[model samples]
Target: MHGSPTGGMPNQGAATHGLAALLLLADSRLPAGGHAHSGGAEEACRAGLITGADDLSRFLRGRLATAGRVAAALAWSACSASASWELLDAEADARIASPAQRQASRTQGRLLVRTARRIWPSATLNDLAKALPEGSHHPIALGVAAQAAGCTPDQAAMAAAYTSVTGAATAAVRLLGLDPVTVHRVLAELPYDSVIAEQHDWSALPAHAAPALDLLAEQHLRTEVRLFVS
Candidate 1:
């Protein structure tokens, strides 16, 4: 039974393989529909709230503390309990007040699942597809995908936090024509490890509110001319 043909535990290299899987999910080029959404950066810019690197830094930091933290918590919960997809999906809906934001999340979630199915097949993901035919929320879908990829809940949470800021950071670079290096330096300096460390359970998901961010999403939807979708 040392090397049984009947699917035994993974080899010692599995941890290294899991780290690679985690990086793949965190990568911006994963075809998860992330490019189209600015996480509200475009709207903030249009309102003159985020004109330069300084404003961008403040905006991204606020987002990371509020929405980003919430996403990481939900993703941690979902990855930790793959059977609770429905519950987590409802929770995501309840957390997001704005209609535009909800639509944006579902759109991204749908795209993530579409790509994840091809990359990392799993019964949980298939079930999620059936549960929300349109799509589960992005964080929930991401959590399930992370579990399938053999990542721990903490790793999933970290990825959630990382993507939350990086998406907006990249969008700022494109919309403002700011020096990409400087913008990235700002991103590189974020206290992500501390933020991730604070996320311990679903109950403490840090629902810090930023009403301006929600309002920005609403206004961004009405803009007659804009670059990013949300």
Candidate 2:
């Protein structure tokens, strides 16, 4: 009888625990500072890029394919390589082109670490905190937190991919006054399965840069009266 990966639990028990953890981490109300930033959706909306649900859908899909893909890959890599936090962080830093986006990522990561530490204490989490005194990239923190919560690398990637659009989608609903049901339906129909597929090379991560998103983030940073932090 072999032990399951989740603290030697049975297969079913481990699966259940992993699912619970995944839901917990994926929840938007986890006090991870995700609500404060709109993942650039606010700026896009203000820039007339996302005026309604249809525009929001396009924005989300593009975001999912670019930034979302990169984030999923990074989270997957981080979950698999606990000891390579520094390298992974560097990779994340390199992928993000905008200074505003970088600051937002670290801010979210810092909040997530603070919250996850109380929920799932582990040496890995402590090591991550020490390695990046300021904070890690959000996906890196998410990957590590997923591992601490008994989730697999694939699960971590899925969580990362899902969040990449969800926050923006939510923001669109608030910013444009779009129908929440319509927004949610668009989210449900996103091509997440294809984006978060398994990757072989952790060193060669996907660098799908969203130049528009980068520009939007920079523009958002300069706006004096903005709704989101990013």
Candidate 3:
């Protein structure tokens, strides 16, 4: 029995490996559908709100601290809970400002799931897929999926923070006519953890979700033509 594989003690070594795996999956460039969404920076560019990499970084970080942080918090909440996907989804919808913006979220969620499934095979992910009703929002999906991936709340928040920054920077290149490398470097200066850590507390997230960033998303949505999701 000394070397037998079957045991109920819970494998610490395997658990460590799992956490490491989660870290990789949570990486921003895991080929997820993030490339399809600009997290509202597209609208900022079209509105001339951000004219350069410096402006893009400021806009991106601002959005991240507000709306992006909220979404990340919801995701973390769902992950830390008993699979309350619907509750989180509703929260995301309620926080969003416009129809088109909401539509973009739902679209991106489905796309992200498709990408996550191929990259990180998980029964929880499959279960969530079956559990989702039509038009589940992206942030909700991200929260549930991050749970399935065994990612920590902090890790999920960082992923989201980086996603917002990268999305805006990428969109700035396309819209404001900036250099992608310069954009990347500009965004790199962002202290995402310091920003995202505001949601590190489980109890404080809901209060933090409503903010000027949400107002910005709402205003951007009213524009006729746009280049990204808010």
Candidate 4:
């Protein structure tokens, strides 16, 4: 299955180079619609909960532990079994309580799948497109994309977990006028790698909840003026 998906052996060198593929999928400039969303950092900032780098670090850690963990697990699961993507989509929807968050996930998922189709066309992705025309949740699409890109499940999980912070870290630079360099430094110092290490069991995906974040998302949607979509 690691090969061309036609029962042929994959190139050894290319398989070993999966790290590069993972990076490309995880990069912020992949045109996957991640840039348009803040993963709730924007709302938290406006609510006076996040004022600077210190607060951002705490927020990122909490997010990594809860929402990020669930996303990474779903991404890894999708890569492990692309056929079960529909069930995984249901699980993602069940995990997300807020309607706004669910919409944001589907929106980002649609964009990522569309972009991935041009770069790494595959029957799996095409089937996914047909099955979930509105688009699967973001992590589900990301996992399938990782599979198409020849990445392992663990690599996909790491990419998913990393984006949980990097997206918000970038947003903080814009919203708070925080020093980009220092914000990145804060990102570098976070224990995201540890979180990824603990996410090996796709079947036992964490269902941790952040009610405050859910409330914030609802509040963000109601706000008259906002910069980010979610």
**Top model by lDDT, which number?**
2
Candidate 1 residue pairs in clash (backbone atoms < 3 Å): none
On the 0 to 100 scale, the lDDT of residue 53 in model 1 is 93
Give, for candidate 3, the lowest lDDT window spanning 10 residues: 1-10
For every candidate in turn, the CA RMSD to the true structure comes to 3.4, 2.1, 5.0, 2.2
lDDT of each: 0.81, 0.88, 0.63, 0.83
lDDT of 1 by residue, 124-181 (tens): 7788888888988898878878877777778888888898899898998998899999
- Candidate 3: give the clashing pairs: none
Tell me each candidate's TM-score: 0.92, 0.96, 0.76, 0.92
Over the stretch 83-201, how does candidate 2's per-residue lDDT look in tens digits? 86888899999999999999999988988988988888877888899999799999999988888888888999999999999999999899888999999999999998788867667
Per-residue lDDT tens digits of candidate 3, residues 1-230? 11112235467754564467456655656676676567667666666778886677778767766766666666656555545556566667777765666777788777777776666566656656666646467666675566556565566666665665676677678876788788778777777766555344444465345344444567777876765555
Q: Rank the candidates by TM-score, best first.
A: 2, 4, 1, 3
Candidate 4 lDDT score at position 162: 87
The candidate that achieves the highest TM-score relative to the unseen native structure: 2
